[model samples]
Target chain A: MEFKRLNIVYGHYGTGKTNFTLNCASALAKRGERVTVVDLDIVNPYFRSSDYHEELKRLGIRLIAPISANTTLESPALPADVYSAFSEESGTVFFDVGGDDAGAYALGRYSEQILKSESWQALFVVNKFRSLIALPGDAVSLMREIEAASHVPVTGIVNNSHVAEFTTPEDVLAGYAYAKEVGAFAGLPLAATAVPARFADSLQDKIENIMPVEVLVNLPWNAGK
Target chain B: MSERVLMKGNEALAEAAIRNGCRHFFGYPITPQTELAAYMSKRMPKIGGTYLQAESEIAAANMVLGAASAGVRAMTSSSSPGISLKTEAISYMCGSDLPCLIVNVQRGGPGLGGIQASQADYWQATKAPGHGDLHILVFAPCSVQEMVDLVGKAFALADQYRMPAMILADGMLGQMMEPVVLCEPGEVQMVEKPWAVTGHGGRRPHNIVNSLFLTPDELERTVKERFERYRKIEKTEALAENYMTDDADYVIVSYGACARIAKSAVLAAREKGVKVGLVRPLTLWPFPKQDLIKAAEHAKEFLCVEMSMGQMVDDVRLAISCSRPVSFFGHTGGIIPTPAEILAEIEKMAGGNA
Candidate 1:
């Protein structure tokens, strides 16, 4: 896998964007990098990177998240520390974007900073298994939607297609062509193929830039794998 | 249908409604249920269906009333406060004997509460959705798949009974992602609505869809007739899941998201040799008193768990005629009660009785 100084991850709501962002943050921190995650998708009440503020901190990551989340006043108010993602410049920073165009609208305010950043790659995650983006064209259109909303152009494509915990190496392989098609459609590179960590070794030779993933943003009640 | 796909509960319900032939969706965007309306906004236009993001929840409900009166499957969904706005129209829809699907993906509430999961709307759905002697068929789904399944079931049953049906989901179920298989057997027969205001021409008499029977006796007659339908629903439509309750001493009663947590607690209690099981009601309005009463014959006590302070506990107590002690354990204001906390409550009840 390649590392950029700043990574902007965006996708349709159920396309596993938050999971990938959290995984990348944890991976970067584990590599002894000073990692900070800008949780810009405050509108999403559940399964956002901000929900893992404690978990991210435990993993030696700094999180600039929404202030009034889960409170009586759940306004999508970003913290003042959000600007530090670009200003600090010492470590890797990731923008865990909101799900869709509506979610991406929040990032429009920080477009100038995001554009001025030295090295940033907006990763458009595509899940073929998800309902809306079952086609490569749909995936590319959503990428454009996010880009239009945030005033930020997407730079890469991530094939994060899976059927939740029931994902298989074959499922990951089956979605490879769809990912490549999406990348081709968007004129972008296939940034990474997110393979479930358990099946990553078996699928190592089959896929390039294999980013092994684990299920983290799961409901507490849905405990078993 | 064969391949399961990961879908948020809101999206699944919206898709399920479309699959069940509900071509009209009118709603206002409200968390954590905005996804459902968003889904409809994207899909309905493509499928030649009507998807109107109304100016307000009141407007949305009125649009649904309009759609249903045309003898079409129609739906409207909202969160707690938005649902409150729609309640007046819900009452009118019931008064007119219109069939439609109303979805309340509940958030914490007394007024404009936080955007998080809470089952506080139990009484609102079951006892009084609006006013008058009216009871909308309320379906409480426990899982994302169940939420999808209930959309079809609710629509079919609503048409069959000529009354509105509600899917009383909380934010947890609305926002959570799960692998779901959309199942629409499409076998259930819908009763014909000859009374629908479909605009009969000069050849036939015009049908009027009105709630105002100005004369008290006429209103009373309609109310009694609606009650007769309610009695039939109570007799036939109550749905419940009895998990490991065949010989359990302590039975846990729950519905919707609380049922999922309570089932987990029941499993944990069983590991400690606690004779505990769960009775989860799928239909909250029908109340499933028969299952509760059946459990009471064998179980010595019952525990009612909820995300609210404890509204459903009263229904549980009433259901079993207080034959056994019905205790309540809950958390309110968008806080979900954990399995451990419920197990602790069950253990205390188990020991207190012993």
Candidate 2:
């Protein structure tokens, strides 16, 4: 029942939030480290922390969710078990919060308690194609909106910039720069930059403040009949 | 050597498919199932495989069919609405007698259902997915380890029967994490697909893998042949897990995510000194008829816990063949019945019978 620093990953829809969290959890759990993922996003049907249950289990990481954590409640509220897990002193815990500003607001209600209870880092994930953030300035404004709604300081940034199968290394680098500027504007660290697996080597030289892609890129391959 | 590790059902499924030689995955983003596609996306490319997030569920399933025709293991996944969109391709694959994996990590359904876990797709998955008398080998994994194991079995059965195979799992199974043993690749005998579209040379005639049989006679023949394969599968592939049923007075029948919740119910019932047991069907298509009938003989009553409005209950009742009174309790459109809720239903049912 030990707790490590709480890592919070959040973003807009299709920003690779769930996938990123899964890979991060996998990397930690593979090393015999105890971790937990809270599936805070009940809104998105596809990309939630719960999807990696089997992988997490394999890695000995406990997953706590509203439904799995508790059997009652009509809406099945996000139980406080995850926060409790984070408050513990040794294990790492990650929260895969929901997409959209509304989803962000859901986290805002509990942000003060989470921030107070644990040494937490909230990374606002940004995919350049998502939201109106084509440039660094636009990203800062959006970050402010997210921060305002969540009422928690956006502690870091992860550049999950990809345009489906068309994402290039250039797009990924631009995401890095965007994260840098956003970090400067928000007085936070640029935690990571999600480069596609194919472009990992190409961006090695270009990336300054970067977190290499732990997960592979999803490209459109011809799945034949 | 297979390595034992913890994995979520969806992640394990992705890994299992890779182990089963599924080299291609086509899917769109959806909750409760994104892990399967995401895991594949991350690993497939590194291992000389293909992973694509298609424009829509329709596109994803068709891409799976395309890969399947090449006689390689291929898969696509989605939640409720997305699964609905992909049914067109599922039916086509059925008609064509193609081998592939169609995973429906079911969420709330009807239309744009909520992201919560659900099991409403029992009928859609077990029944002929498309037009005609087609059959898909439907395997329901209860845990993350089972997810990996079943994906391998799904591929084997699909290839063995020359039909589409489906892991008719729900969001809970897809999203929940559990410890798993990752079966190493190169251990299992990769099924040699001789009828693949690697490329046609002048040495042999070009191969066309399609479901469009122009003549009625040919279509009928295809259906009849497919039925024969299904019958063979029905005989060989039915699997179920029975828990503490040897001295139980009542049995609960369920599958996929529902079965896990039902397991908790059985445990609670036993704790309260009620003689209850569980029969979890691992294969939905074959339906574990013999096992249900066998368990029904000793049990006083059978309760079916499902996430649907009693879809699997029908199959459970059908399987028992009137060995006992069969009852059902469920919540539809992605509403999950809690272990306590299911136990309450069980208590009510058992009381009336007692």
Give the Å shift of residue B186 in candidate 1.
6.6
Whole-model lDDT, model 2: 0.74
> How do the residues B287-338 of candidate 2 rate in per-residue lDDT, one tens digit apiece?
8898887887778889888887888777877777776888888887556677
Best by TM-score: 1
Native-to-model Cα distance after best TM-score fit, residue B20 in candidate 1, in Å:
0.9
Task: List ranges where model 2 is wrong by over 4 Å.
Answer: A1-225, B352-354
TM-score of each: 0.96, 0.66
Q: Show where candidate 1 strays beyond 4 Å.
A: A70-72, A88-90, A222-225, B184-190, B352-354
Reference-based lDDT, residue B143, model 2: 71
Estimate candidate 1's alpha-carbon lDDT, on a 0 to 1 scale.
0.88
For candidate 1, what is the TM-score?
0.96
lDDT for residue B337 in candidate 2, whole number 0-100: 72
Q: Is the docking of candidate 2 incorrect, acceptable, medium or high quality?
A: incorrect
